[model samples]
Target: MATLEIRDLHVSIDTDQGAKEILRGVDLTINEGEIHAIMGPNGSGKSTLAYTIAGHPRYTVDSGSITLDGEDVLAMSVDERAKAGLFLAMQYPVEIPGVTVSNFLRTAKTALDGEAPPLRAWVKDLKSSMEALRMDRGFAERNVNEGFSGGEKKRHEIVQLELLKPKFAVLDETDSGLDVDALKIVSEGVNRVKESTGLGVLLITHYTRILRYIKPDFVHVFVEGRIAEQGGAELADRLENEGYDRFVTSTPVA
Candidate 1:
């Protein structure tokens, strides 16, 4: 089984004053077919971990290492990380103006696989995934994320998840801004991928609602830029009831 491991990870970002540390010595190991839910308050560096794993240039890894199946992940470029089977669904997905959704996905899949997918198979999979997400057929022709509502953007991300079939997916606050119906739909899409591909999920969210559907195998409580506590699904229920007062201290940064 493939494994993604991070040890003694220390990340810092530049601000007006100086470089501010976000992740302080985080150690996590996720194996194939395991769903790990990372829950914490805003500014706890939850999203920072996601971005860092995706090789986002804004966050600097000051020390420690990240490895995928013993391969040095930090040395790989951003796109290289994706081709190596790491996928990130951002909290705020960016718009790619002038690029149609169909073209962008096909291009991304082609880049990752080193060859374009067969035209017939690609179109069939695209249509099927979109229907499963309740997205309109016309969305395939629309510019990627152009004029899309928050919910629509999220659904589009899941469609990519199902089609691309990455080994591991870092979903950063995918439940945010989604209504109850949309949330269930999106959650089902994720669950479907897990069932089909045994995808490892690093799901980052502040709310417990999504947890009801995703059903993580491990619940990690992130506080002050590190994982302060961890447990099973019961831990998530405790969080919903008692909140993060026991874990939070000092100031927080985004």
Candidate 2:
């Protein structure tokens, strides 16, 4: 099975004042076919972890390593990460003004796979996944995330998740700004992809609402740039009841 490993990972970014450390030393291991939820309050470095794993140049890795099945992930380029079966669904999906949804998805698939998919089969899969997410057929012709409602943008991300068929996916704040119905629909789309592809997920969020729909195999509490607590699905229930006060007050690891 594929494994994504992070050991003693320290990350920082250059701000106006100076370089600010974000991830102190985070160690995590995710295997195929598991959903690991990383939950914490805002600015706890949850989103930083997601972007760092995706190799965004903004976050500098001060030390440690991120490996995919013993391969040096940090050595690979951003596109190489995706080609190696890693996908990141951003908190704020960006708009590609001139690129239509169908073209973007197809181009991405072609880039990842080294060749275009059979056109007929690609169209069929695209239509099916979009329908499962309850996206209108008209969306296929619309520009990528251009003027889409927040919920629609999120659903579109999941559509890419299903079509890309990555071995691992980092979803940052996917549940934010979604209403009751939209939340459930997005959650269903994620669950469907997991069931079909055994996709390992690192789902980052602040609340337990998304957990209700997409059950996590493991729940991790991020505080001060490190995992403060971890447990099974029950941990999420406790967090929903108790919040992060206990974890927040603890001393951070150096």
TM-scores, one per candidate: 0.99, 0.97
Model 2, position 149, has a per-residue lDDT of 99
Candidate 2 Cα lDDT to native: 0.94
Q: lDDT scores for all predictions? A: 0.96, 0.94
lDDT of 1 by residue, 82-139 (tens): 9899999999999999999999999999999999999999999999999999999999
- In the predicted model 1, the residue pairs found to clash are none
Candidate 1 vs. true structure, TM-score: 0.99
Worst 10 residues of 1 by lDDT: 245-254
- Global CA lDDT of candidate 1, please? 0.96
Model 2 agreement with the true structure over 1-254: per-residue lDDT tens digits:
99999999999999898898889899999999999999988778998999999999999999999999899999999999999999999999999999999999999999999999999999999999999999998999999999999999999999999999999999999999999999999999999999999999999998889999999999999999989899999998898899889878645422
